[model samples]
Target: MAASQKPDNVAAVMKVFAILEGLAAQPSIGLSELSQRSLTSKSTAYRFLQTMKELGYVSQEEESEKYALTFKLFELGGAALEHVELIPLANVEMRKLSEQTHEAIHLGALDEDSQHIVYLHKYDSQFNLCMNSRVGRRSPVYSTSMGKTLLAWMDDNRAQEILAKTHFIARTRYTLTSAQQVLDELPGIRQEGVAEDREEAELGVRCLSVPVFDRFGQAIAALSLSFPVVRYEEQKRDEYMALLFDAGKRISSGLGFYDYPFSRS
Candidate 1:
């Protein structure tokens, strides 16, 4: 075994983390002091620092030959925090929507690949025959109301790219099974400020969704209400849409988007 290498490379990993922590503690530090603080050799620390610098997690000052933590780590942390913050901020409005309708309420966001919508938070319907779903569940983007709402608000080129990559499997007879069919609906969805799934993803289940925007006015998530078709009333659609739109606006405002484009009137 190499002197600097530990069993299964654990020591190397620890040394890297230790150096990171040391750099975090100091505004800037020299190679000698950093290696000593991290309990690693100067050569090992230099190699790790060079790797981290290349990865954008650390920066080196040319004049002083000192290493400092970079904002890349902070930016990653901020993104994670923002996602975490979204749940609580959205839950408040979700709870209100649940109380108002006693129906299933879901908060969904685009999955990492932009090919699906993942449920992040959900409030089950009070009724026994309501839609069944859980957090972390994923559904195809072309067939779900939440998915359409997300796609509708996205930039045209990006939305087109995602649509092009989608596998339009027909989950139900009503599912849009082609890119053109899905694309044709986006304009109306954007105009109405809501999207609908008329038993497209699952039989007897209908969903209505509104876009939730971020600080940049980009849609970050979709707030949706689901109901059994038996309980869904054509006349009451507007009433439910109002509730969802209100909730979407509130959650978006919490995320720093005040210019919610949808109006109930």
Candidate 2:
């Protein structure tokens, strides 16, 4: 490709994706709405839509004269996801977090049957006094940061159902010892897009976690950073949250979720 033609090619590619995103955002839309949403002229948008329709990636409702995406994207996405192994994909992001924070990093998933967070992968902290945990260790959902994160992003009824079964054992003085207490805190966790274990799961250990989503936008896993209270700096809470959220977003994206439901800023 010639350097002089690159800008036009890039702009054309952007326009196509923008139109595709616009269509994906709603059930269907007329050309005018799509053109405005995509920041392209009607003629350009229509031309792109026609090309996509011919390619079987888009469909046009004859009665409404509206454009919408076909299941082609879903088919493509499903094929891609089929080849992706979750733990290895997560390890790339987890390793980066482990290096950056030098803390115990964990990847956990909800074990719904047991109502616990199962550690899928972990990186032990470089410090000798780090959190002692291993892959496959199960921790109560009511007391751990990763567990709370998984619950926070879940549907309220489903979350409540899981909470109802929880024994709510007080692992420490900080633990929330009731289902209602955990339920009350879930909204705040969702709003903040993070969860905290303030020595609740274990005395003298503090952990922060963020949810990791899949293509269906379900919170399938959580990424967490753990530190002993002696090593955890209160002032660096924001920095720690940022790192965890970043890793969560990256891992979620790898799982085919483009929209990470959290404010980066």
Candidate 3:
């Protein structure tokens, strides 16, 4: 609080971020150049750089001694993006789908190990009865429409790898119990551009899902509409599928996947 004393904490934070911004603007730089870019003394920049390096956000090349940002920042960005970017983008489409059908809509993504689907967001149906689910709840990938849609879009090798680790305990009589059985269904799901859970994960609950692709054409998530069997109208299946696919395409487009693979069948 003394006049002669600087606000050490605030100054240090500013300097650290200044250095990070400088490093980000350039591919790589030595301590002297980095100090100039960040507008700090070489010693101060070096101190901050060393700390950041230890924290894995900055790295110095072995041969050049030039410091640069690392994949850690990219990894952190991706992690932040999943919740920050994806949910908001998907929520817009989910709300539209919910309005159209007045049915439960869900946005689900693969968990860290890729063995399960975790609900990231949902819109409850207008009806008194709907699927009991919440954000962050995890479900087996083999028994849910969202899970099947995600798997159907994955390459066989990767799909097989995930299936190899999956425990195919039958959630219900309709649940596919073997990897081969699910594998056999993938082609049809892919061809139809949608997947169905015919009371697979839970009795009397039927769901349909379509893939939400990312810029790289990877199925980053799945969008689904769920209804109790009593509320489901078999004749309106195609209509519901169209609504889900429309939302999926819109959401995928917002994610930078302009060429969504799914087409009406």
Candidate 4:
């Protein structure tokens, strides 16, 4: 067997990982020094470096013949960190909403591939009859308040691209059945810093949502409150909106975004 593939194939894996660690320890590295640090043959180190470069994890300085780590690793790490940070921050606010309103509370994020808002965390209403949803369940973007809130904060073209891919199945008579219908409402929703689903996704359920922002001030998720039509009071709309906005602001602030656009109640 080739030396690079020796030691039950673990040595080659360890060698490449060592090379990555060595590359990370400095801005850039030459093949000879990287090989020396990783304790691998120059040939093996070069092969692994070439593979990492092709995979977009490493870049080479043409003039100096040195290899450097790329932003790709940072991008992956940032995505992981965003999810990790979002849930705990959201949980704190979600618990508060649950106690205050005794209504279904949800934290949702966009799933572009599915063209839906995925419930990331949720608190069931205290009542026996309430909105039916759970964590990991997906809902149509064009009809759900959390979905609309997420899209409203996104770039117009990107939001349109996602809308174009959506199947737009009408889950209820009130559901908006076209992309243009949903698109037209996004501007107003964004302007108000909130969105609503008035019996759109379900017959008896109404929902209100506010955007959750990240450190970059980008809306990365949405927080929502759900009420049954029989239990909902028109006069309490403002009260529910206030609760959602308060939770959203605290969650966003915890995520490093201090300027949550809406006024507090």
Question: Mind sharing the TM-score for model 1?
Answer: 0.80
> Distance (Å) between predicted and true CA of 213, model 3?
1.4
* Model 4 ranges with Cα > 4 A deviation: 1-69, 112-114
The lDDT for every candidate, in the order shown, is: 0.92, 0.87, 0.90, 0.90
The local lDDT score (0 to 100) that residue 81 gets in candidate 3 is: 85
TM for every model, in the order presented, reads 0.80, 0.68, 0.75, 0.77
Local accuracy of candidate 2 as per-residue lDDT tens digits, 1-265: 6534679879899899999999989998999999999999999998999999999999989899998899999987964464346788889998999899888999888773748988989899998898889888999999999988888888899889888877777889999999899899899999998899999999999999999888889888888999999999989888888887788888888888989976558
lDDT top scorer: 1
* Residue-by-residue lDDT tens digits, candidate 3, 1-265: 5523758887788889899899999899899988998889999999989999898999899999999999998887887685577789999999998888899999998998888999999999999988899989999999999999899999899999999988889888888999998889999999889899999999999999999888778888999999999999999989898888888899888888898765555
Greater-lDDT candidate between 2 and 3: 3
Candidate 1 lDDT over residue span 1-265, tens digit each: 6645567578788889999999998799999999999988999999999999899999989999899999999987986787798999999999999899999999999997998999999999999998779899999999999999989998888999999988788898999999889889999999999899999999999999999988989898999999999999999989998898888888889999999998677
TM-score sort, best first? 1, 4, 3, 2
Judge candidate 3 at residue 207 and give its lDDT: 95
Candidate 4 lDDT over 1-265, as tens digits, reads 7765579568778888899999999999999999999998899999999999999999999999999999999997987789888999899999999999999999998874738889999999999999889898988888899999988998999889988988878889999998899999999998887899999999999999999999999998999999999999989888888888888999999989999888665
Instruction: For model 2, name the residue pairs that clash.
Output: none
Candidate 4 to native Cα RMSD, angstroms:
4.5
